[model samples]
Target chain A: MAAIQGEVSWFCCGTAWGPCGTAGGGACGTCKSGNYQHAWPNTSDACYAITHPDTCGLSMSRRGCGFRHYTTNLCNGARVGTTIADCGPQTDLFCGERTCCGSACGSNRIIDLTPAAFSAIGSLSVGLRPCSVDTV
Target chain B: MPQTLDRRRLLATAALGGVVGATGLGSLAPDAAFAAEAAAIEPGAPDPNFVEGRISKISGHLLLVLGSDTVLHSIRITDGTSIWKLHPTTFDQVAIGDGLYARGVRLPDGTLAADSVWVNIVNLHAHIAAVGRNLLHLDHKGQRIVAHVVQGRSAAVYNGTPAVSDLSLLRVGRHVQVLGAWHPDTNEIDIATVYAAA
Candidate 1:
């Protein structure tokens, strides 16, 4: 699949504590805060209805649970591979949101990685980073 | 530049050794080690090795923290520990009452041997409601925030480009993710990096 450019953020899932305690096992019922996992906005019709990437004038492919995608942190050139474990990012809420590293910039929030996957490519403290998502 | 390089080298060496503050064989990167440690915790559970809270006390290299959930944590800082306040700093710069997020190894005694700690760091997603000289009015989650741009320190990254100090490209109505230092108990923040589209 062609690469999708957008903002990437993180969420804690699985059995979690504190504010993350309510995240549960995600939409796939298999998410873990420590796993290399991610949430795709269009995991299902219900998921797509909520995320609504099209409302932001972006077309995103519908990928299902366990589908693999690679996310690159534009700031540092760091990358990680992860599987879909949930549906998320409520994309319509933050339409027109954009982030960039240099010449590479992504518009809108497209993907949310698990904490373990996110911290691998970027600092959790930063919360969000410009990213490119590819199927390679 | 040499000093920065040396510090990075030291950190790399420490990470490669997989001994942040205790003896262990793990990944060759500090983040990798942290990921490995996190995996050991039960799924959907609070990470045992990751602690987030405010520093209530600091004695020597140890930090006494009161978690947001009311849990108490003892975090031990080591030479290998990388600290970031606004920028990369030393342990001494970590002051009391600063909020922090630490990732490391949880020792058998329940103390966390921190590999990395971020103090007063906040990453916010907001829209540019207005722009003024050296400042931006942000609307975050329906709340207004005053974000100040620290000259020379604040940078902007446009369209996946390298960061630059010029922020004139920021436009009202555009959404942005800001990484900066938060003033305790305030809606104000000092911008470190602003990521947005041109």
Candidate 2:
């Protein structure tokens, strides 16, 4: 599939530090802060209801558990390959908000990675970054 | 369409299995790169149980957020809520402007009674412009970003391999993707993982 452009962020699960404790293993029951995993907006129909990428005019496919997605930070061309550990980054909530670096700007939060996965491509403190998601 | 892909995957998996069985490598390595793309869900669909945004206001245990799409979210934190900001923290650690991703139940009032909240996290791709002592100069599009290497915290992956602590494999002019913590209002970031083609 072609690359899908959007915003990317991080989430925590498994045995982790601080507030991360509240996060259990994600919807997949396999997520952890240390795994190379991510949360995809379209994993199932129930997940679609919450993320509602349609509300924001974005079309995402319904990939199931263990699906792999390569998320590339548009700003730096840095990329990370992660498996789907949970469902996430509800798209409709922040439909029009934009995050930019240099001349690259992307709107909508489409994915959320675990700490281990997130820290692999970008910083966690920055909160969000414009990214493009692809299959390989 | 997914069924078609599944059939393809099954054939690939079978071929890989045969190869692994013959070589006694104890693993099946098919066209993993291609498989990665094939496993994606239908477009526009997302996981329903999660929310992402920034803190706009806080009232008691309820944290008000403005989503990346400019939607407002009122997330409630119970004693069961786990909040993370760089590290495991408490509700007091959360502040306005802090970006968050909360996973929990969506209540009838539209508030998400969160179970876990991770604040200020980012994942991006960049080109390694230069490397220094504990520092990597990166180019993200037309922008220059300085990423600091934290010992024991930073790792690298070469050619879709497992992550390792040795970052010596990093080279100048190589395109790499980074995952780390963003230092608000700066071009600096903390390096977590650097993926490069070995």
Candidate 3:
């Protein structure tokens, strides 16, 4: 699959306490804050209908549960491999938003990762980072 | 060296033995940690071991927090806990009304035994509306934000490159992400790192 460029952020999901307790199992019903998992905008028709990446001039392919993708943090060279485990990011809300590192830049929000996966490649406190998503 | 070994032993005990006394490690049980590691975990659930809120009161090593959701929390700090306020700091620097995010092991008594705490940290995604000497005017989610570049501490990372002190690559009208320490109750932040395209 071709590489997709965009911003990546982290979210927590699991049997948790506090405000995160209501997030449940996400769209795929299998995400965990401790696992190497991520949320893709186009996991299904229903998911795509909500995220609407096309509104931002990007055409994202549809991939379903458990598909693996490697994400690289553009701010640093850090990378992590994660499997699709949810639907999210609500891309249309931040249309035209862009981030870049040197010559590599991506527009809009495209992916969200579980805390364990994100903290592996980037600091959880940093929140958002430009990223490249690939399947190799 | 002995202190380090004792800390390690306490952490191991917290992981395996399910309970540890309130000594140098605070009161932490293994149930929250084990639940996080369980395979039948649900995504989007609240993390039992993580809490975010504003400090409403502080009593010795115990901090009383009021979460954004109006939930009350008790967080216990220990010698092993790492604290960051703008930069790394000691527990005494943590003040009332400061926003914080804590990750730790939740004890059976519901007090969080914090392993780390970040005070007043913010990660913002914004457009560089303008730039001035030692400052950047940001448009974040339709709100104006003023980000100050500390002479010695501010840095920039461009195009997957290593961070450097030079921030000349930041361009007006371009989108950038900023990691900084926010000034609570204000529209300002102190820039730590700005990630931009050159």
Error of 1 at A64 (Å): 9.8
Taking chain A of candidate 3, what TM-score results? 0.95
* Model 1 Cα lDDT, one tens digit per residue, B1-198: 233224334444454443333223222333333322213333223456567778999997789998755779998877677788777688888898887777676666688777678787766667999999999999875777789999878998775566899999999998777877777767778889887854
Predicted structure 3: lDDT: 0.71
After TM-score superposition, the amount by which residue A1's alpha carbon in candidate 2 deviates from its true location, in angstroms, is 13
Prediction RMSDs, each to the true structure: 6.9, 17.2, 8.5
Q: How well does candidate 1 score on lDDT at residue B150? A: 95
TM-score of chain B of each: 0.80, 0.66, 0.81
Write one digit per residue (lDDT tens) for candidate 3, span B14-102.
53444655455433322112112222223334456667778999998899998755779998886656677767679999989887777
**Model 3 docking grade:** incorrect
- Model 3: DockQ against the native? 0.12
Q: CA lDDT, every prediction? A: 0.73, 0.66, 0.71
In the order shown, the chain A TM-scores of the predictions are 0.96, 0.96, 0.95
For model 1 the local lDDT of residue B172 reads 96
Top candidate on DockQ is 1
True contacts kept of each: 0.06, 0.02, 0.02
DockQ of candidate 1, scored on C-alphas against the true complex (2 decimals)? 0.19
